[model samples]
Target: MTSTTQQHPLPLTGRIAVVTGAASGMGAAIAERLAADGASVALLARRTERLDDLALKIKAAGGEAFGVSVDVTDQSSVDRGAEEVRQRLGRVDLVVNAAGVMLGAPVQEARIDDWTKMIDTNLTGALRLAHAFVGDLVKAAAEGRTADLVNISSVGSRGAFPTHGVYSATKAALTQFSEAIRADLSPADVRVSSVEPGMTATELGANLSDEQLELLGSTFAGIPPLAPADIADVVAFVVSRRRELNLSYLVAVPTRQV
Candidate 1:
């Protein structure tokens, strides 16, 4: 077996993890994987029913997960969610900043409101989590434990694709922020990285207009798109390694996604 596929027990068992936007898609997948690998997971999202369903599934499978509801764009909501996790799980060892939104409105017709929503959810959301969780991650690091702050970035960060101007900007900002944190937190042993995904089959595009979604569907029709599970697989690999091992950055996109 390849080293990656070989039997590796959960390196993060007993370690707490907080995943935002955990109701569905990549967030849900990552939460499931981490719990499967023995980490106690805190699931955060705007929807409680979905979160509850996911949490029940985890419990059924003998893994631990707590359902939480928080609007990432709201500071109080974010703070309250973090506090709840702290009270329940004791310490947070991993944070996957996955709460995000994308509305494909061309610059000409795009409302300022839509732009603000993207900026708030995709960019500010990640920042709020980092600000709230960094102190705990540092404390974990001081105890000789490696904590991770993995930001879910996008390939859109590097280019302006048609109506994707605002969305691209948010992702680009997130990528830059992840890089900056890694550089600044070296002494704290907090590993920061961005997982940039391209052409994944998730509800991430659900916010786009019907026409835009149709266009995207046509554009990716021929490709074998990556699933949320694929992204989760990569995340599990990154988190299961020894404290010294760090996955600086990972860009997992479809091979035919050009």
Candidate 2:
């Protein structure tokens, strides 16, 4: 008989978790995983219709899920969306800032507009969600509830690619920002964690041009691209930890990649 390691499933019954960018890709996968583990999930993204569809699916499957429409680039929109989630869900225990945009362009031809959009959507976007949710997390901590704030980063944050310069910088900034928040929130029971995944197979890379996609292809060819669910599993594990054990950082990649 072959021996296999059994993974620990997260216990999240009745807990409330909010996931941004939950319309599709890793965001959707993460939301589904949390709901499956017994948490009530609130999905947020720019596409309200998509969010509605996902929420329907989760509800059909006998899970608790609610969807909200939000644009992370707009601070006021994020603020309102957060409050709406709080009102509907009653409380928030976990917040995942998974909303983002990626732009690949050479420095010479990359429009400043593209760069600005990338910054606003990727870096500042996370900032907006975190700011809006920090209050809820603090409240949970004060009440001695288990809480978490997870920011998705990327291996590109450290790896240098020909056209990935701008996008990489944005993810790197997210990592640093998460670190600072982790330190600041340490006194409270709220845990801040960063998860960095490499070459994931998701819509996240759909923004690339043909040539840019080819470039990414070469770097990822030998390595098996991880599905969005893999990253979601990592996050689930982090949150499942005892309140006393804070998972500060997690880096997961396909085994073949290394």
Candidate 3:
């Protein structure tokens, strides 16, 4: 008697993913998870050393990954990074705009520079990346493959909080932009999604002021915040769905934060 054996295919096999802010935190986790899901990943961030190390680890784990030093705030840098990813990993099938900054200050004492930085990185940076790789995404979709654009937003976008004015505004804008672009890209089979995470144990709070830091600390003193891996899991799920379905809007927050 002859026996037949079957091999299961990886969900993201032969796909290429580009993750901004991949040097650490949620971006790093997302990159790693995508690589694990059989997608070749390009890690983009300002921290070349961190990216390099991450790439090494991914490669060592029998996955394909490359690190590109990119400052999302600069159009030229974004263009160059996108070109490099195409050259290295072929056309990008997935792009995650995860590079962002959160600097909280009351409106009365808000620093113009901080707000500007937030806008540049959170709103404009996402736009720059979208503009640069959108054509690539279109091409990928035209090839009858799944293509996705995932934007990392914050729950602050939907809620009001002291000192989170500008940060929240940027996230809100990102959410709206994602919805608009999703409609535009749907014809090309490219799906756009915005993920809003309430709180996660990452470096996002390092830039917070003393008062903001204290507020955060006291707010979740005993509650364990969501982990970077938690958000990464959601991102992976959003992009891994069947080509016919799209998970447009998702909010993942700690249950206790409810």
* TM agreement with the true structure for every prediction: 0.95, 0.94, 0.97
User: What lDDT is obtained when candidate 2 is compared to the true structure?
Assistant: 0.89
| lDDT tens digits by residue: candidate 2, 148-219 | 999998888888878878888999999999999888998987999999987788898787899989987887
Model 3 residue 211 distance off true place after TM-score fit, in angstroms: 1.9
Candidate 2: count the clashes. Answer: 0
Cα error, residue 11 of model 3, in Å, equals 1.5
User: By descending TM-score, how would the candidates be arranged?
Assistant: 3, 1, 2
Question: For model 3, what is the error of residue 113's alpha carbon versus the real structure, in angstroms, after optimal superposition?
Answer: 0.6
Pairs with steric clashes in candidate 1: none
What does each candidate score in C-alpha RMSD? 3.7, 4.3, 1.3
Off by over 4 Å in 1: 1-9
Candidate 2: which pairs clash? none
Clashes of each: 0, 0, 0
**69-169 per-residue lDDT for model 3 (tens digits):** 99999888988988898888888889999998989888999699999999999999999999988998999999998999999999989988778899999
| Winning candidate number (TM-score) | 3
lDDT of 2 at 116: 89
How much is the lDDT of residue 11 in candidate 2? 95
Worst 10 residues of 3 by lDDT: 215-224
The Cα error of candidate 3 at residue 221, in Å, is 3.6
